[model samples]
Target: MTNRPLPRSFTHVDTWVFDLDNTLYPHHVNLWQQVDARIRDYVSAYLKVSPEEAFRIQKDYYRRYGTTMRGMMTEHGVKADDFLTYVHAIDHSPLEPNPAMGAAIAELPGRKLILTNGSRDHAREVLARLGIATQFEAVFDIIAAELEPKPALKTYRRFLDLHGVDPARAAMFEDLARNLTVPHDLGMTTVLVVPDGTKSVVREDWELEGRDAAHVDHVTDDLTGFLQRLLPKR
Candidate 1:
């Protein structure tokens, strides 16, 4: 959290857009670690490469393309469904329900939606584990974006068009600061959800970069606290 005053700019927001995964749940939970490992395994087996080679290729694809799956789809002709299904088949038990966060999200004004690069099934499972499945009106997922991932302008445009969300009246929350860039440029209030720096989490160096960028309007390590502060006191 910054020393600056709370974001009063959010008052005009009529649609609250949240990214799934690390944004909704604390990163310390390590749920994404399982998914990351599964993705590595998939890559190793799919390409018949060694573990080290797989790791290198996986990250290289991720860097070149917004997502590893997207890169595979483009270069190797991998089917999106096959890749998504394999990577997301991980344990969800690590994610316990957050009642306070759920309450805060349910209390937020107007429509609440999930915008995720992961599949809708993955988003639904995560939301179910968080006990906030019913809070969001809809999920705009990678499948909905025709296998394209976030940070892509066209994907964001598809979401806006499909949901009828007016960017000026919407607020977007994401764990990765870069993902908020397009939303901010489109006139939405951008909030960066960062790790609290208390625990180690598996992530790339670039994924942790760009927190102080101009596109980020607000940054918070505590999603629940941040959302709670956005609403008027009871």
Candidate 2:
């Protein structure tokens, strides 16, 4: 992560939009393993290609297309519903209920929302696994947003407008550094969750040069700890 000065203080905002998936659950759990396997299988089955070729094709398609689902839609004419169902059919046993997280979220001083690049079913499964599904007012996932994923200003703008959120009064909490960039630019306070078990560093090239560093208002290894600091003690 970039070594930058922290914001002096963060006001308790009216709306708090959270990113699902790795943000709700730690990344070290390797939840993506199942998702990746599903993607590979989907490519092989639908494209009628070899496993090796499917793997390569999946990566290539993901690179060219924003998401593997998008690639499937364009190439194999697979319906989005079928794609989401097939990919998210993974065992969610690794994720356990986090009561500490529930308490922290419950103590927060505003409405909370979930914004994710996954399907709503996937987001619901994750939140349900974490035992914090009830804390959010609504979940806006890739399907709800018409397949336009995050890191795009248009998505963020549309999300804000859809929810009647004022960017200046809202804050975004995410685990990915890249995902926080556009939110920061749109005047939302951004917080990056650098979980302690993260294997790789989470800095982007732009952040290293201090170009996108200003957008990130805070970084912490613990989401609950950050919330504890920002909210009153229970």
lDDT of 2 at 116: 89
What is the per-residue lDDT of model 2 for residues 19-44, given as tens digits with 9 covering 90 to 100?
98767777667686688889999889
lDDT of 1 by residue, 1-234 (tens): 767534438889999999998999998897888888888899999999998898899889888888889988898899999998899999999899999999999899999999998999999999999999999999999999988899999999999999999999999999988899999889999999988889998888888887878888888999999999988888
Model 2 TM-score relative to the real fold: 0.85
lDDT of 1 at 171: 95
Query: Which candidate tops lDDT?
Result: 1
Which residue ranges in model 1 land beyond 4 Å of their true spot?
1-8
Off by over 4 Å in 2: 1-9, 198-212
Candidate 2 contains a number of clashing pairs equal to 0
- Candidates in order, TM-scores: namely 0.95, 0.85
